[model samples]
Target: MGVLPLVHALVPNSVGNLGSLLETVLPWAGLAVPFALLAALRRRSASAAVAAGVAAVLWLGAFWPVVAAGAAADEPNLTVVTHNVGAENADPAGTARTLLAAGPDLVALEEITDDALPAYRKALDKALPHSVRIGTVALWSRHPLTDTRRVVLDPGWSRSLRAEVRTPGGTVAVYVVHLPSVRVGLFGFGTAARDRNIQELDRVLAQERQDKVLLLGDLNGSAADRSLAPLVRRLKPVQDAVGGGFGLSWPAAFPLTRLDHVLGRGVVAVESWTLGGTGSDHLPVAARVRV
Candidate 1:
């Protein structure tokens, strides 16, 4: 487990997409070191203690930055928020108010149903005047949105969109996406659909001409997963810049892994954090950045 992060890419996924599974819960592996160390102390085994210490070192070496992020502080220039206000969310209007309370300059939402769209629009229209939406994904900006269009990653439907936000700082391109979901069934990691979408999204991102870009929404995969390496390599995760928090944003009741993320290129993330549940299964993710 200690070495999983370094060799995650090399781990074969032909069987069950084990590599992706391990990466999804990679941070949790550090918990094992404490148990190992306790066992070593109880047994008074020098070799066991040495092994535990080594594991501790390796785990800390890889994740210390995430631990340190808790202390990060900054006066941000722009704030962006992203949330998957579940299709079945009981309180879409309340959720919209929760997001508005964060005072984000830009907001991206996913899994928005036709029924809930009106509630969201009514709640956010006045504050965030400019908006663009296609299919279930939407982008709302406090500034003007221009050159807006639907980004068709999958044919016959729209689940992604791109818009240019003319903010006081400058014009920045923002892409809001809701990638295919990943499920773990009897067949193993059911990520074929999600993986395909990731590749398609990567292709679209590659051709982007914007000097500054922000990608937000439910990616359905962890940033640590090798399958998401292409996008992770191209854009920096805002959580990483904060220096010390996992920013896990899913299963709001008891979030285990981060499915929602705020990623950007040609921008600096000064602060990043996750918000409380908004009557949805997933929590909202927020980032304050300098564009």
Candidate 2:
């Protein structure tokens, strides 16, 4: 487990996408260190102690940077937030209020239903007048939004969109997405559907003409996972620039892994953090970017 991070790609997933499964919860593998230490102390063997120390060093070497603080020299020009306001959330209006409290320049929402759409529009109308919604995903901006259109993803339905925000600094291309959720049941890691959607989005991103781009939403895959290698290679995660200490934002009640994210290209993230939970099961994530 300690060496999993270094050789996750080599692990096979042919049976049940085991490789992806391991990568998704890789951070938790560090628990082995403590267990090993306890065993070494109880046994009082020099070799066991050495083995425990080695595991600790290996685990920290790979994940310590995420816990350590990071800083940016540039000041921020834009603040963006993303949230998957569960389809069954009882308080849509209250959720909007939670997002508004962040005072973001742009906001992205997923899992929106027609019945609750009015509540969101009315609540965010005054602050973010410029907006666009395609299917369940929506983008609301403080500045004018133009060149708005749906980006084809998930043949079953539309859950992704692209828009250019006319900010004071310049026009920034933004994508709001909610990839298909993967399931773990009798079958092994069920990620075929989610992976297909990710590949389609990757193609859209590759053809993006804009120099500066930001993607906000619940990707349903961690940046550390190899399944997101395409996006990880093209874009930098906000948490990497501004430390948020794991930046986990899923299962709002007790988040164990990060599924929501703010990723950017040709922009600097000065601040990144997760907000308190609202009516949704997933917590909202916010980032201040230097445009």
Candidate 3:
């Protein structure tokens, strides 16, 4: 139990997001750790009780974001949806329709390939008249998009893009990003490239001059994940600020980690939540924010 809190903090999250994964599942320990603490107390194990108490403190501290309350989503300035329409999704059209039916002011997508691009464009063209596709990342908006360009966070590929949305309230800079994926194995977490990609994106965000910015997509990391501190510090995760709970949205069937997120800078998240899967590995994350 004593080692539990230490483990949580010292986790080398950079290795393969091992630390992040640990944090993602840390809440479960809240239940198990106390039970163990009670058993230890009953057994009159002073050391065990102390250790359990430490673990409980650390666990709750790490979990505060999930339970914290914030502004409501009512009367939102903007309603956005971000999804990772899996590259192999069987029904891209269906996913597109489902996303559109949500009536989002903007839709940000990751994992869009050349072949799948046309399908999405065709499906969204009528409803979202303004759209931009730069490599694998795309943004379709009900508002006009201008000054769009690829962000180039990774080498040899495009996984991020930027555009300015002319909304009813004002123009907000929108970043559609698909950060490099991390992996795990005997080799531990493989976040080298992913880390590098994050560094580059971090630099770009640091220089961002926009007053209101919306970051949307499959970041491949959670808001609480240590590896994402740089971005998290600059932006407010909609889910963490207003979500009722974990709001997990990955591995759709048994959604666990929140790999997809909608974060904001200079905006207030009124509401946030994850929707049921739309033939993708990740469930769509939606948020309403006050600009």
Best by lDDT: 2
> Which whole-number lDDT from 0 to 100 does residue 39 have in model 3?
89
List per-prediction Cα lDDT, in the order shown.
Answer: 0.88, 0.89, 0.83
Give one digit per residue, the lDDT tens place, for model 2 in 41-101.
9999889889888888888888887878775788999999999999999999999999999
Better of 1 and 2 by TM-score: 2
Error of 1 at 263 (Å): 0.8
| CA shift of 139, model 3, Å | 0.5
Sorted on TM-score, best first, the list reads 2, 1, 3
Model 3: clashing residue pairs?
A: 16-189, 72-270, 73-270
Clashes of 1: 5
Best candidate according to TM-score: 2
Provide the clashing-pair count of each candidate structure.
Answer: 5, 0, 3
What are the TM-scores, per candidate, against the unseen true structure? 0.95, 0.96, 0.88
Please give the RMSD to the true structure for each candidate, in Å. Answer: 1.6, 1.2, 2.9
